[model samples]
Target chain A: MITFENIDVVYPNGFKGLSNVNLQINKGEFVAIVGLSGAGKSTLIRTVNGLVPFTSGTLTVGDVVVDPRSKAKLRRLRSRVGMIFQSFNLVTRVSVLNNVLVGRSADTPTWRSLLGWYRAEDKELAFQSLERVGIVDKAYMRAASLSGGQQQRVAIARVLAQDPEVILADEPVASLDPPTAHKVMRDLRRIQQELGITTIVNMHHLDLARSYADRVIGMRAGEVVFDGPVEEATDEVIEQVYQRSLTAEDIVTAEATQE
Target chain B: MVTTSTAERRAAPQAATVRPEPPRPSGLVYLGLAGLAVLAFIVFWVIQESGDVLLIPLGFVTLWAPLNPVIGLVVMLVALAVCFKARIGTMAAFGALAFIMMSYWAGATVGFTLLEIPERWSNVEPRLMAFLDPNWSYIWTVRDQWLITISMAVVATLVGCAIGLVLAMYASPVSSPNKGTSQTIKAVNSVIRSIPDVGWALLFVAFIGGTAHGLGPMAGILALLMFNIGIVAKLTSETIDAVNPGPVEAADASGATLTQRNRLAILPQVLPGFVSYGLYVFELNIRASAALGIVGVGGIGSAMMLQLNRFQFENVAAILIALIVVVLLVDMFSMYIRRKLL
Candidate 1:
């Protein structure tokens, strides 16, 4: 379980990234965080991994407390909490298999990883993870040659290799086309179900969030405006989160169907 | 097998459209060609018969042993043909005239000076042979100093590159742990870069060699180290700055420690550039080591100086040949490594 109580994140430059944010997510649940640009969605996701340090808050991931001051503790927490990015940030010049193996760095010995030497078991796990993502055939290919959706799958395989308890995806499908976005969303949903891992995705498209997530958390400015089951997160609730009427672009399927 | 004329075989395409033929040169082009040819012939005739005509160029033509009329005519015709084919008729005519005229005037005065080379070589041959008469004895005796030169460069390159890599990592703002560390490293890099290799060599020689009179190789090694640091730091730091930040972010998101992030994310991105710069600095150090020897900092440069000062051309030549061979071998090796890395 992950819990946040009165979390306030203020940048060194005096910009408040998160303010009085309080939330609790249960184990093995799929939740989607939705908001406009600069609405603290990324900040909330990053804070779980200690990438964004909270100024005044008590946040807990699984059993350990989130403390950015303690590097050792942060690494320990990050090991069990895997995060995926919108850019699918695999080292493009490297092989697909090697990019996925980067997730195993937390487990692999420093010296062994430094020397590009992974144990047979680590390689086997990496290959299995790739197989699960349906990109086992592209394991040897360079990450740069793969399309954006394929690259995002490689990134998913990377997270799977880590075997994390919770997965945080910050705008995972923001860079992909509509069809590809749905494909990736299905992959995430299926993976969450299969592994019984807690999945939190920051989504731009409201329709995708409603379609994929069991629960939805809405944010505005630096505060959470609504948090409820997907059935309760109506079109009016989402419109209130953005403080505006919904446009065709706000619905993923609306634009996708028009095409 | 069947054969058809190209035009006949492609007649169907030609029947579709009547394409206009390219325009041929006008009568004015032929007139210009004729006029250029006549001018060239006149110049050729004048160059050949100037000696008899008592023309102004006769004085220049008589300066050297004049070319035979037949050879002169052949050369003029060949020159004209080449010039006209290249469409430089008027310019070519003027150029040919000026060249012939200048050569005759200059060669006449300079011709006798060339004879001195053979005369001087004959007198110097025995002296040169007498120096090499010992059959590589001098080279063997100086083997210890040569080893000093070679070993100093090797050690300096290895140590300097190691230090430089660390300095470069911290100097890059993108990969640096903090702004203060990056700024401090960059300042140190600039200070080191400002010092010339020879200046560093001279300073080390004066400072370190004051008490130890024979530690010239030590001075050379230290100087080469400074040069390597400056070069490698500047090159690798820029390379680090230019590296893609995506992998670095991914590494962070995966919970990699700072060391792991830098080693796996940052280093691999810039490793090729780092290796290439390291090899380049090594090649530079080899050449600079020789230069350092001239200022009493030990290397082949000092040996070459000693030989030249004593008029030992044969030994000087041998040292030069050794330097060339070593440099060439290093150059080929560096090229191979760079090709593989890049």
Candidate 2:
């Protein structure tokens, strides 16, 4: 389980990223977070991995506490909660298999990782993760050579290899095209179903969230305005959460909706 | 399932392609050519003179004269060719003519005859034996001094690179702990870098208040350290600044410690450059060690200088041969390492 209790994040320059936000997500649940730009969706997802620390909050992932004050504790917390980015931040100079193997550093000894000595089991696990993402044949190729959607899949393979309990994907498909975006969303859904990982995705597209998420959490100006199952998340609720009427740009499949 | 469209393949009629002609040189280029022609004619006239009016500027010209009419005719023909070409070759020919003029005025001459040898070769027999004799028995004369010179360079380069690497990390804004630390390191390095290697050597020799030959290799090594630190730190920090930050972020997100992040991400990217820099510093140190001997920091240079001062040309010759052999060996070794790095 992942829990955020009365979390508030205020930057040193006095910008509030999150304010009095509380959320509880059960294991194996798929939740989509929707918000306009600067509405704290990214801050909410990053808080789980302790990538962005909450100023006043108690965040617990499994049994580990997310405490930025203690680096050892923060590292332990990060190991169990994987975060993905819109840019698919893999080291493009390295091979795809080597990019996946970076996940093993959390488990490998410091000396071993420094010397790039991976155990046979870790190598086997990396190959299996690549196979799961259906990019096993491209594992030896450089990550920069892969297409955008393929690179995102390699990133998903990295997360799977880490075997995290809660997967935080912040705008995973925001950079992809319409058809490739649908395919990547299906891959994320399949991975979630097969491994029973708690997956939280921060998405801007309403139709994508409606199609993929079991539950939707809406935010406006650093506070959650709506929280319920997909069926209860009506168009009126989304418009209220964004504090404006929805436009065609707010939906990825707007053409289909218009027809 | 054969889907053939209504598109048909056709060939267009062929015609000759015409390329545009290149632009011609402007009148200004021809003007420059005329100026060069005037300069060459003046130089030819100067070369045929009887005295040293242009000797200093045209030192190479005085060796031969345009005394013969045939030679004068040949020079005029060359000048005419340069006038038409009006290019870099024309400018070069003008320079050659100037040198010929100077040489002719200087009354210079070419010689192939050997000069007489000094009878003091027997007095410089010990230095001669050192080179020709396989046993190198004369090495005992300056055994400790030579060792000090070699060790000073080796140790200084090794420790200097280490210190430089640390300073570079702090000097780089990206990897530094804070902005203040980065600026301070850069400031300190800039101050140290402004001092020349020989200047550092001279300062240390004076500050210690000892004979130039007796203060030990510490003075020389210290000078080398000062020089090496500036070079290595500047090169390394520039390289560190250029590394991709994406991998560093990935390492952080993957729960890597600071050391692990550097080792796995930044180190691999900069290791080759750092090795190349280290080898280059080593070569600089070797050459600088010889130079530091002038200030009496205990190197082969001091020994050779001492031999030359007493008018012992034979001894000086032996020392020069030894220095050349040592420098050649070091250069070859450094070249091999650089090739391997590539």
Candidate 3:
């Protein structure tokens, strides 16, 4: 379980990144967060592992309270809370298998890793994770050599190898084409379900979010305006959150433009 | 696939709509500033030549008569500016510097140059001809010294690279985990870099005695190591910090340890950079070793010092050839390794 108690984030310039936010998420829930760009969606999710520190709040992940994270605690929290990026951050010069193995580092000794000598079982686990994401064949190939979709799958496999308890994906499919984006989101949702990890993903396309999310949380200007199950998330509620009524014509226009 | 160019360029029209961002001055601004520099140079030259601007022919055509060195530079600059669109002005400035340096050397060497050693040959030490006659067989015989010098260069490089690697690893913000700790590492590495190798050898010589003389190679090695260590550590740590945070975050999410994260995420990313840095240090070490001969540090350079001291220009020429060969060889090796690594 993860809990945020009245969390507030104030930047040095006095901009409120997140304002008195409170939320809780349970494991196995595939939550999709929808918001306009610069709507504190990224800030809210990054606070779970203290990637962006919350100025005031009791942000707790299982047993860890993410306030003033000491180096040791931050590492411990970071180890369990995996975050994905739109950029698919794999080391370009290295093999996919080695990139996946990096998800296993906190479990090994420094010297061992330095020598490129990973543990036997960890190696096996990395390969299995690669297989799960269907990029197993590309394991020996350099990360830079893969196609965008394949690299995204490798990223997903890296997270699987991490064996994370919580996964936060920031605009995970933004860089992908619609079809590739759909497949990537589906793969992520399926993996999250299978692993039973709590997953919160930021998404732009409404249809993709509706199909993948167990619960939809909507935000605007650093405030959560709507939170409910997909069935209860009316277009009216989306209008209330977005301050723009998204009609069927709007959807058609969006689809047409995307084409 | 979205093929609509209009949609792809949705934000393109906004460039004109938005409040125009103030454009910074461009290369023309630099060109205007360069005019100031030229004015300054002219003022200095006027003062230097006692207002005799005609003696220093202001243009390219007549400057090389007794060559007002700066005039040659100005000519070169004009030629380069025409050929390379002003890019060569900078090169011309440096060229002028080189010209001044050669002039200085010419002044220093006048007495020595004037001492015309007899062109006649000696049976024991034949006349210094460009040809390596029976008299110059000693250059070939000095192969053992050449090997020893080159070997010393290699040893110095290895030691410096090792220390640099270790310091870099610990001081790296990613591995150290504490900002304060990493800062201290940066500071210590800086101090190590600031201390010169000759100074290090001199200090160590007082403590170690006789260990200092003919120890130019060791001195060169230590110096190369110290300087390279500072560079390598800073570079490697930055490289470590830059290793994409995605893999690290994944490792962390998996409940991995600090050791695990670095091992899994950081090391692989930095390996190529490490090898590249190693090669860079090797090239630096070869060049640096040549200077260690004054303090009796081993290497072909030490022999050059001895020859120069004895005023045996032929022997000095022999040592110079050996040193140049070693340096060039090191350069080739560094290039090959860097090419392969990158």
Candidate 4:
């Protein structure tokens, strides 16, 4: 379970990244947080992995309380909850398999991993994870050579290879085209369902959240303005949360184009 | 009328709502100041060196001829300044040219007024040595000396680099990971670097003198090794510091232990730096080994000093050229590897 109870994140430079972000995500839940730029969606997700330290807040991932002040605890927590980013974040020069194997570093003995001697079982696990994401064929290919959608898939495989219980994806499809974005979201949703891992995805497209998420979270000005089941998250509620006039044209256009 | 108004509004430009003054030409003032300053210096320097002539065969060259040594001389001066600033190549070529043109002729003129050893000594090989010099058997006699010194240089370089590399890894900010250990390693490296190679040779000669059969070459090789280690480490650290933190972070977050992260994540990224730094140190050590010979460590440097003392300039020429050839070849290889890295 990942929970943020009145979490307040003030960056050292005095930027209020997340303010009173009270939210909860249960195990095996597929929740999507939607917001425009600077809306605290990323900050909320990053809290789970302890990457972005909240200045004042209570964030619990599983049983561990994330406190950036405690480096060791943060590192231990990071090893459990795998993260995927917009940029793919795989080493550009390394091969796809090597990139996936890095996900195993959290579990391997330090010296054996250091000496490039990953256990045989770890290698088998890496291959199996690649197969799950439909990229086992590109195992030896350089991560840089793959297309954008392929790269995102490779990143998913890397997290899959981690065998992480919860995955946090921050704008995972923002850099991708619409078709590729849909495929990646579908893949993430399918994988999360199959693994029964609690998955939280930060998304920009309203249709993506509606299509893939069991629950939708809408944030505005560093606070959750709307949180409910997909069925209850109506156009009026989205309009209130976004503080923009939602139109019938938007719904019609979004639906038509996604076809 | 309404449709035309809408089209006009669209044509008016989205950006026309605000116009920012093109960023002021702030760079021009600096350029103008620099140009004026350069002009002033030329005028002032010309006035200072008024008596020295800068004669150019401008008219003759305009008339039609290829060899304009004056223009060539100007090119030479500019190239020398650039080489001095950037160190474009080995210094030997410039040093040799200076000796041939300036030192040989100018010193002979001074020697004419000073010690006056006949105008003809000119480091010329005399007929006596040419006729009496030993042939094939002499090389066979000295083969053991050559082999041992060559083998010692190789062993010393590898052994020294192994120790140096381990130390460098610890001394590097990347390897230490923490600030305190990194600072301590830097202090030790600085102390090691301050002792000059010659001082090392002299100290070793005093304690570990050629008491053992081949200790003379051993001592020279060791000093070269120590100095080159410092040079390699200093050159290599920047690459280590500049290593992409993303991969390392990925490895770390994956639960990689520090050693595993370095080997799996860090080493692959830094391989190019290692290759280039290793070759650069190898070249430096070669030249250094020759210098080490002067402190009773056996090599061409000692041989040159011996010939200089005996006034046997011909033998010195042969040895200097051989050493230059070796240095140049190594320099070429280093250049090739560096090009590949970039």
Candidate 5:
């Protein structure tokens, strides 16, 4: 379980990223946070793993109080929580297997990781992760050689190799085309269902969120405006969350058709 | 109303056709021309009086004659005409004129004269003939010294590249643990790179007591090693700084420590660049070690200097050919490795 109690994040530059936010996420729940640009969706999700530390208030992830000040605590927390980025973030010069093996870095010995001597079990895990993502054939190829969609799948394999309990995806499909976006979303959804990992994704595509999320959290201007099941998040609630009426641009399917 | 306006426009063109005035050179151009003329007069006065002319040593060569003023006058006039006629920008025309004048001034200061080469040819005829008939047997004598030089280059380049790779990691802004560490490493690297290879060799030779003390190769090795470290660290750090930050962020987010992050995310990206620089430094070390012997550090260069002192031009020529062949072979080998790696 993850809980945030009156969390506030004020950047060093004095920009308020999140203000007095309270949230409770249960285990095995797939939640999608939706907002317009600068609506604090990414900031809210990043706080779970302490990537963006909350200036005040207490955060609890899996029964441990999240403390950004303690390096050991933060590392332990981050080890159990996997984060994905808009960019695939794989080292393009290395083989896909090597990139996936990086997910095992926290568990491997420092000397072993430095020397690139992975244990046999860890290598097997990496190959299994790649198999899960259906990119096993490209495991030895450089990450730069893959297409965008293939690279995203490789990123998913990397996360799977980490074996985290909670997966936080920040705009995972924002850089992909519509069809590829849906495929990646489907992969995330399938993995969430199969492994029962608590997955929270930040996205701008309302249709993808509504289609995949069991619960939807709407954020606007550093505040959570809406939180409920997908059925209750109607157009009116979404418009209120966005502070504007929806357009074709807000829906991935609609925008894809216009193109 | 449109028809009437069209008729008026047609009649307006027939009234008068005045051509616009052609653009004239700016005042800055004339000022630059006047400055060049003044500089020319100073040059002429210096050449005539032969005063305040710095004669830089060009080995056995000397100045042949004073520059002719008529040639200088013709070149200046032609430059001034082009500046005015081309109507280029003031800055560009001034820059061109200033560059030409600076070249002439530098040449005159250095006492550069093409005619001196032919005039002194007779003096070099004996050496040329001796060089053409090189003593092939001299190679057996200096073969060990040549080996020492090549070995010094190989060891220095390899060991220096290893240390340099680590220092480069600490020096780069992206891979460094903190800003203070990065800046300190960069400052030290700059200090090391500022001194030339020969200067380092001389310092070591002075401290270690030269070849007579049986430590000449050690001095040469130390000098080349320092030079290699300076060059490789600076270049590899620049490559490290330009690596993709995305993988670094990913590693951090995966809970990897600093060392782990650098090893997994940073090293692979810069490995090719580091190896390429290592090979290049090896090539440079080969050539540099050949000259360190002049400062009393033992190598093929010391042997060559000894031959030159004893007036054995033929043996010097033989050693030169061998050095050239070895350098060419190393160059080819390095290029092949770089092509395969990159």
Candidate 6:
């Protein structure tokens, strides 16, 4: 279980990223946090792994308390909580198999990883992760050689190799096309279900959130305005959270149809 | 219809005949023009004061030589013509003027005179002839020294590159453990690079003794090694600084330790650049090692110095030909490797 208690994040520049955010997320639940660009969706998801330290609040992920003050504790918490980015940030110069093995770095000894001496079990787990993403054939290929969709899949494999208790995806499909975005979302949803890991995704596409998430949390500015089951998040409720009426650009499918 | 359209276009310009004024040159341009005038006056005064007299100063000896006034006047005239005709910005015009002045001053200080070449030609003829018909037997005599030079360069480059890789990691801002370390390494590297190869050779020879003590090649290799470390560390650190931050962020997010992150995320990206720099530094070391020999360190240069001291121009010419061929071959080989790697 993950919980945020009265979270308030004020940046050094005096911008409030999150204010008084309180929520409880159960294990195995696929929650999508949707908002406009500066609505703190990414910031909220990052707080779970202590990537974006909250200014004043207590956060707990599984049994670990998120504390930025403790470097070792934060690293330990990050190891158990995998995060994926929109840009699919893999070291393109290296092989796909090596990129996946980076996911096992936290578990391995520092000297061992530095020397690239992965144990047999770690290699097995990496290959299995690659197999899960259906990119086992490209494991030896350089990451730069793969297409955008394939690279994103490799990033997913890297996350899967971590075998984390929770997953945080920040705008994972923002750089991808509509079809590829849906495919990646489906992969995340399937993996979350199979592993029974709590998944928190930050998305701008309302339709994608509704399609994949069991629960939808809507944020405006720096506050969560609406939190309910996907079925209850109607157009009016979404407009209230956005503080503006929806446009065709707000829906991924609608934008695709226009194209 | 075409004529009508042309007439309409012509009339449209007359209808808006109130054109905007062209912008005026700033006060800085006028200031530059004044500066140029002052510079021209200074040059004229210098020529007037130093008319037709050149002094060549050798160590503890001074020789009086003749300077041709016509050459100085012509050079000045051409500089002035270029400054006026080029119609360049004030800074560029001043740069041209400064370049001309410096060249003239340098020539004067060196006692350059066209009249001396013909007057001295007879003295140089025998030596030139000896160089043309080099002593072929001299090759066997200096062959070992040439090999020693090549060996010194190879050892220095290999060891320097290995050590430089580690130093670069600390020097680069992106991969450094702390800002203080990065700054300190950069400052030290700059100081090392500032010392010339010959300067390093002299310092080492003074401290470690010379060829009499049988440590000539050792001094030469140490000099080249220091130079190589400075260059390779600087270049590789710059390459490291330019690596993409995206992968670094991803590694940090994966909870990898700092050492693991740099080894995996940063090293692969900078490896190609580092290897290319290594090959380039090796080429430089080969050239520098030959020069180090002149400072009493054992190499082909030492053999050439010995032959020159003995007035054996033919022997020196042979060493020169062989050294040129060797340097060219090394250059081509290093280029080929760099091309293949990059």
Give the alpha carbon lDDT tens digit for every residue of B41-81 in model 2. Answer: 56655554343231122665555443433343455446545
What is the TM-score of each candidate's chain B when compared with the real chain B? Answer: 0.60, 0.63, 0.61, 0.58, 0.83, 0.80
Superposition error at A68 for model 4 (Å): 3.4
**DockQ class, candidate 3:** acceptable
Q: Which stretches of candidate 2 lie over 4 Å from their true place?
A: A253-259, B1-163, B170-173, B176-196, B199-222, B238-243, B269-291, B297-342
**TM-score per candidate for chain A alone:** 0.97, 0.96, 0.93, 0.93, 0.97, 0.96
TM-score for candidate 4: 0.71
**How does model 3 score on DockQ?**
0.37
- Candidate lDDT (C-alpha), each: 0.83, 0.78, 0.71, 0.72, 0.88, 0.85
Of candidates 4 and 2, the better by lDDT? 2
- Please give, for residues A233-259, the per-residue lDDT of candidate 5 as tens digits: 999999999989999888888333321
Q: Give a tens-digit lDDT track for model 6, residues A1-259.
A: 9999999998889999999999999999999999998999988987887778898988988877789877788888878888899899899988999999999989999889878999999999999998887889999999999988789889888888889898889989999988878888888998999889889999988999999999999999999999999999889999999889999888788333321
Query: Across residues A1-259, which tens digit of lDDT does each residue of candidate 3 receive?
Result: 8888888988778989899887888768999888778889998888787777788978888877875557677777777777788888787778999888877766667777767888899999999999988878888999999988888888877777777888889888888776788778878888888888899998766777787889999998888878889887777877787788675522211221222
**On a 0 to 1 TM-score scale, where does candidate 2 land against the true structure?**
0.63
Model 4 docking tier (incorrect/acceptable/medium/high)? acceptable
Model 3 residue runs over 4 Å out of place are: A245-259, B1-136, B169-176, B210-220, B234-263
Q: What's the lDDT for residue B217 in model 3?
A: 52
What DockQ does predicted model 1 obtain?
0.46
Model 4 Cα lDDT, one tens digit per residue, B1-342: 545677678878875677654343333443443343344334433433223333334865634322222333344455445444453333433553343334333433343232234445664337335324423333344344445555656666677666776666677777666888778877888887899988888888787884244578767777777776776666566566788776666665555566666776677777777777777777777677667777777665565566667765555555656667778988998899899875
Shift of residue B49 alpha carbon in model 2, Å: 42
The residue-by-residue lDDT of candidate 6 on B85-140, one tens digit each, is 55555566667667766777676667665767867999999999989999988888
- Model 4: lDDT of residue B20: 57
The predicted structure with the larger TM-score, 1 or 3, is 3
Sorted by lDDT (best first), the order is: 5, 6, 1, 2, 4, 3
The candidate that wins on DockQ is 6
Ranking, DockQ, top scorer first: 6, 5, 1, 2, 3, 4
Over the full model, what C-alpha lDDT does candidate 4 score relative to the true structure? 0.72
